[model samples]
Target: MREFMVELTTAVPEGTDPAEVDRRRAAEAVRAGELAEQGRLFRLWRPVGEVRSVGIWRADDESDLRSNVLGSLPLWPWMTAAVTPLQPHPNDPGPTG
Candidate 1:
């Protein structure tokens, strides 16, 4: 199988706040079902950036990725998110341990 990099940017769905309750709820959902089966969550930090969270994902393909997001994340139906397919590069630095 091939490897890919997925960048998922999530918005705190309207009344949701990324700092307090929302993050906790999300973390719960991650623990309850998602993280074990589908995602590795390579990066999650709040030091400083354009986005609040950043994760590096590994999957079999696009469909697998979708199955993961829709199945795991407790995001609202109207929540906004973006997923990008990263190109493979010998020198890409990519996601590291």
Candidate 2:
């Protein structure tokens, strides 16, 4: 049970909204029952790409993170996105007393 940060760079094709596409991807991932299983996905951030759409997946492991992303890539949206591995952060969101 390791924590990781999964970075996603989304490139929506012409006549597409990166935000919308990303939302759709999220929904599909949820429907497929992969997002949560992959990890907690504590937080998500964006506004870091050409189209201003990036995501930070708070995943548990590499495989789970990859599977979550793959579950809804080009299928959910007619666009291309890269789910890259980012260095894990030192801080862990552990239970606080």
Candidate 3:
């Protein structure tokens, strides 16, 4: 598996119903949990006062990450993501280190 740093920014379109937004957000949470359980999603964080998130994710490759993992998100239609492939550095301490 390859790891990536993903930054996601969400923008709900104007005139969208609040209830619909709430529903999708709920679904998105559930999907995120599933990914985490599958060991594909490592960590997620939201910046202060921003409707954006940064996370660490894993997949077979960028194609798999985009077509399967990210495309499955409920809020994908409203989200814009930037993905950066991660590489281990010799001096860096890993997860267990």
Candidate 4:
């Protein structure tokens, strides 16, 4: 698997129903959990006071990440994601014991 750093920003369109937004948000959370359990989602963080998140994700490739993983999100239509492929550094300490 390949790793990627993904930053996502969400913007609900104007005039959208509040109930619909709530429903999608809930579904998004569920989907996120599934991805996490599958080991595709590694870590996530939200910047203070921002409607955005940064996360580390794993996938077979960029195409798989975009299509199967990211495109599956319920809020994907309203989300803008920036994906950066990650490479291991020789000086990296690796995982903690």
Best by lDDT: 4
Clashes of 3: 0
lDDT of 4 by residue, 1-97 (tens): 9999999999999999999999999999999999999999999999999889999999999999999999999999999999999999999998877
| lDDT by residue for model 2 (13-55), tens | 6887778777776775665355556555545556634443445
- For candidate 4, the lDDT comes to 0.97
Regions of candidate 2 where Cα sits further than 4 Å from its true position? 15-39, 48-56, 69-97
> Each model's TM-score?
0.51, 0.41, 0.94, 0.94
Off by over 4 Å in 4: none
What TM-score quantifies how close candidate 1 is to the native fold? 0.51
The digit string of per-residue lDDT tens for model 3 on 1-97 reads 9999999999999999999999999999999999999999999999999889999999999999988999899999998999999999999776773
Worst 10 residues of 3 by lDDT: 88-97
Ranking by lDDT: 4, 3, 2, 1
Best by TM-score: 4
Q: Candidates 1 and 2: which is better by lDDT?
A: 2
lDDT of all predictions: 0.52, 0.54, 0.95, 0.97
